[model samples]
Target: MDNQFPIPGPSVPGEAAPLPTPEEATPPPPSYQAPVSVKPPVVKPSPIKIILPLLAGILVVGLLVYGITKFIGSRLPSESVTTGQTITLTYYGLWEPSSVMKPVIDEFETQNPGIKISYQLQSPQDYQDRIKTALEGQNSPDVIRLHSTWLPLFAKNLFPAPANSVSATEVSTNFYPIVSKMLISGTQVYGVPITMDGLALFMNNSMFQQKSLLPPKTWEDVLSAAKTLKEVDPLTGKLTRAGIALGNTGNVDHWPDIVSLMLLQAGVKLTDIKGAEASATLSYYTDFVTKHRVWDDTLPPSTVAFANEKVAMIIAPLWRAPEIKSINPSLSWQTVAVPQLPDSDIVNWTSFWFEAVGKNSKHPQEAWKFVSFLASAKAQQILFDAATSDREFPQPPANKAVASLAQNNPVVSPFVTSFETAHTFYTASNTRDAKTALNSRLIKYLEDAVNAVSQNQDVVKALVTLNNGFAQVLSQYGLVAAPAAATTP
Candidate 1:
């Protein structure tokens, strides 16, 4: 049995052991076999296979998260970010103080949780120069308050309103007609005005009552009233009381506006400013001194004259109401719409400020959002109320809806009524512009022409010079997009 059950040899280090003989390898008998425990051999997986699956899962999860984040962020405000930082917009405002704009700013920030407004009231001195410099600079205000006449001067630097924020259609529909003309370019709107103001006739109630005259409805009516109400000292041949403030830029306040209104009413295209209508309009304006003998340079400014009861009537914006009141609180006065052309549709003038977004602003979208809010009907009402509480009265709202509500307000009604048919030109006065500004430069030519006419110069020659001057100024300012018009002198 021992010889038959041969033992196996030791295995070589590098080689497998030889197979055992049948006798040596014989299995134990089934009945007498002792229990044997068996364990399977342990196997290690390939590192590349494990790592590839894990990397693939991680990449899929990362892509899913990134896609979700992008989709969610696209719907939020353009100024908003996932980091949850509030955007601050720098606003350069004129006239309205920080205290006046604070409520509106706060309301806007409340509505748009992602934005806050930093308001600064800019001084009127050199405002045009400063704003132009700011717009050209890298660090520019996000929002700016600009005059409607300055549109041509600043349109290149202004950011057009995004259709999603404020569309041209919305601007035309919601605001006054002049708004569309001033703010809308093609399908884009560049700005929105909070107030609507133009020329209105202010009459001393005592003077009108004594003469039994109603508010002038036509130019004829105005001329007649001027003649009837004027009081001249026969002994000194000096004007003790003036009829109207219509002639001579030296003493007439807002002479440019009055002149522009007359020109527009006479169907003179200010851009061209030629033809018989232009001559007649200028003559009509100057005639109040030279021919009509109603107003002259002998008196104080038109506003002061009206306040002192030295002038029976004056054409001025409603903002002057406070000044006139401050000058003479006990004086009885009434406001009426500016006189219209006889047998013609109503045509009035407008000069007011609007809110614009800077083209170079880092937060243009946010800026436009705040401006759009300020232009809304709700915001207009709020602003009008705020102004009313803050001061004696506010200018008529540019929002047609809000203006309509003030139809019964005596202080605002005349301007509100005029706004419906109002138009604006670049010749607006009191803009507090630089000497080299478009308005100031253009107004110089206007002043020269008016002075010439007042001094009895040939109307046709004066107007020819005026037309050439207008061409030069409009072309220089890039206000006229057309080819330089040929001016005949």
Candidate 2:
């Protein structure tokens, strides 16, 4: 009744709220009023609550990614580990796949499974240059096969063998004396000699027999044979057959061989064994070509002349034996030490090749192991057999014992004999510049003397010119020793 809906109660301020105490304010419950039909408040989910589950899922995913990253990192090989385990080696191709090296390499692999090797074969001509480039680029192979002639050039680039890996004195004692000396630089042995090749006189036996002459034992005998071989055509005044082909350009790149042979024969120390002097023992060489007129440029190249039977003699290595036999099986040829100089014992040029370890190699130890195995007596024996049989081109074994094993093989005997008396050229600094100067200028001077004689230039004049040039070269390299106030020849 009284406009019946309850009026809003805010009309009274705080004083009206004290009107009733809790006991007096209790209102009697409406008698059995129908239950209120109140609906529950419509509640909506919070955006924050929904986002929390998604955040937890994202966190779990991130942790899984982190764990995976860590697992992969742990499994990768460490750089240091890789560095300690691998080695790479490089060598020039000595023989094709069918030769002695194949089995040796396979055997080495079988014996050492933990160590891995990578082999690279290069042409002999390009090997040194390639090695030099690799060394300069800091990518050098751990091991290399070096020519004995080239050892001096590359000695500086090699790493000394690890101490105690081999017994230095014992190893040195195991090789031929000449072979041993070639591998020594001061007290350090920079290389291990694997094989050697020495100069030998290769003769056409049939030609010698036909000429009613025996094989030459002395330079004089050779001269006589050469003289008899030359004849003049009555009508043309032209020479028919050359007595000898002995020039640098011909099949004879054997200038060092000829020079060393003559020098040894003359009792000249190729190098001042004491390192006191550096001089070319050119007199004998000059005399041989000029005095005898044995080498005339008029003849065909040595290879052609020998192949065609136009010339009867060639100074070649044991390696050439097979090729000579192959060219003419009926040629009836034999090998002998280089003809001795007058009043001198027989001597020849001995050249030995070495296996060296590169300075920048990652696997120097492994590389050295391979080299050592190759130089072992067993390997040397295999090499000797292969060479003697002509299955592979022969190189003299560095091991004297191995060399002696070939004594019974006729084709190898002369080479072995020559190795006994052979000597090598002394390399002063073992530098490219030094080698180039020696090979280009010094060698050329000798070649020029040969050329002059072949062209009929005055021998004395040529010798004097060569001497002067030699002096200039020595001075250029600062190799000239102190001049004695009074020097004796």
Candidate 3:
């Protein structure tokens, strides 16, 4: 999914307690002393002699206890406070099953010896709300799995990777440039991504071969191919086969990503997305239905349509490939980098989950240690290996070193290679943030804008509304859009 960084709110100081009055501070002095009434009473039998011996005995016992306690404490392991007792870190995670994560957790525990990972797989349904609740509650998990777009919601409640564990330089240097943009704020790194994913064009290889066509590389190429591949019933003027999946969010997965990509490719600043640049981009996206008529609302959802061979091409993240394969085991398909604007630098979009430590965690140090390990090259490779064993295709590793080794793999190469040019915004879908979530709320505005354009309405007003929605939602999370850099693909 999509994600961003955050600015923590200023802390409010507690009111100091008022000082006590003299009467309350001073207690009656020595009530045990005998009353020195006007007449002096006979002294008790050698009271001083009896008290001195008792005091001597008490002091001897106290010294003995102190020495014994010191001896025991000194003999114990130095890490006993944090490790000897064995801290069990509760990790709330999603997507990865126990089998896939057990190996990675086990490896971390073995190395640390003092930390135990209590990994719990979470359902994606209402995960943003659930996680937010957990993070704010008294018993939050030590580590949590969050979409990159969720940083704005959870940043204040999260513990940035401590210097002793993962550093800002390490994050920027090792992972995709987008990771730094999403997870880093100044000197603090908020989260560590285990995998990298983004939109890619999944095309039916057989369909292309039959038409003697190749995968499109630019907007012009995409249009031409869509025209040739699309099949329309001449008499009825109905679509029999869709050239590609686009135009409407109703049947399109990742429509938010597709729209954001078009905007970025056109150099429309997402923070202030309005004006001609945005209007033209939105029109072009909706035109796949309104003007070109290659795709329409009548078709099945993109993934389902592609699986059933009703569409020649669809844009989706690598994770969806497995679902498509399950739908049609015999279908011949290939993935390519998302099409870019002609004569412009390649700008790709990415949305993936990362591991973050809760600020309220009792063991923040140990929690970050485990998260840092998860982000390491060795752990990423292990995770990739385990995931491949448990499933057919896993999202490419976020670590560049690990991703580089997988560059030769056909299904993974297109996405892995696109990281250098990858960027992401909050308009990512399927993150399951909450009804009131930042991404979900922002997506609603975007959907409205797309629907307006597809229906041939005044898109400028829609764009204006969408831009305001972006600002409002981002401001709620204390975030202002940091525009992605213009880069050559």
Q: Pick the candidate with the highest lDDT.
A: 3
Which residue pairs collide, candidate 3? 1-351, 2-149, 3-148, 3-149, 346-489
Kindly list the per-residue Cα lDDT of model 1 for residues 121-147, writing each as its tens digit: 999988999999999899989999998
Task: List candidate 1 segments past 4 Å from native.
Answer: 1-83, 481-489
Q: Give each model a TM-score.
A: 0.82, 0.70, 0.82
Question: Regarding TM-score, does 1 or 2 come out ahead?
Answer: 1
Candidate 3 per-residue C-alpha lDDT over 1-489 given as tens digits, one digit per residue, 9 for 90 to 100: 001101111221111111111121113586678767697788867778899999999999999999999999899887674535789999998998999999899899999887899999998887888888899999999999999887767777787776699998999899987888778777778888999888899999999999999899877778778888999999999999999898888998899989888887777767677667678888888878888888988888999999999999999999898999999999999999888765566688888899999878999999989999999999999999998887777878889888866676798789898888887887888888787887889889999999998888898888878878887777656566433445998
Q: Model 2: how far is 433 from its true place, Å?
A: 11
Which residue runs of candidate 2 sit more than 4 Å off their true CA positions? 1-88, 92-98, 230-234, 247-253, 269-295, 387-393, 426-437, 452-489
Top-down TM-score ranking? 1, 3, 2
Worst 10 residues of 3 by lDDT: 1-10
Clashes of each: 0, 1, 5
Which of the two candidates, 2 or 3, achieves a greater lDDT against the reference?
3
lDDT of 3: 0.82
State the displacement of the C-alpha of residue 14, model 3, in Å, after optimal TM-score superposition: 40
lDDT at 40, model 2: 92
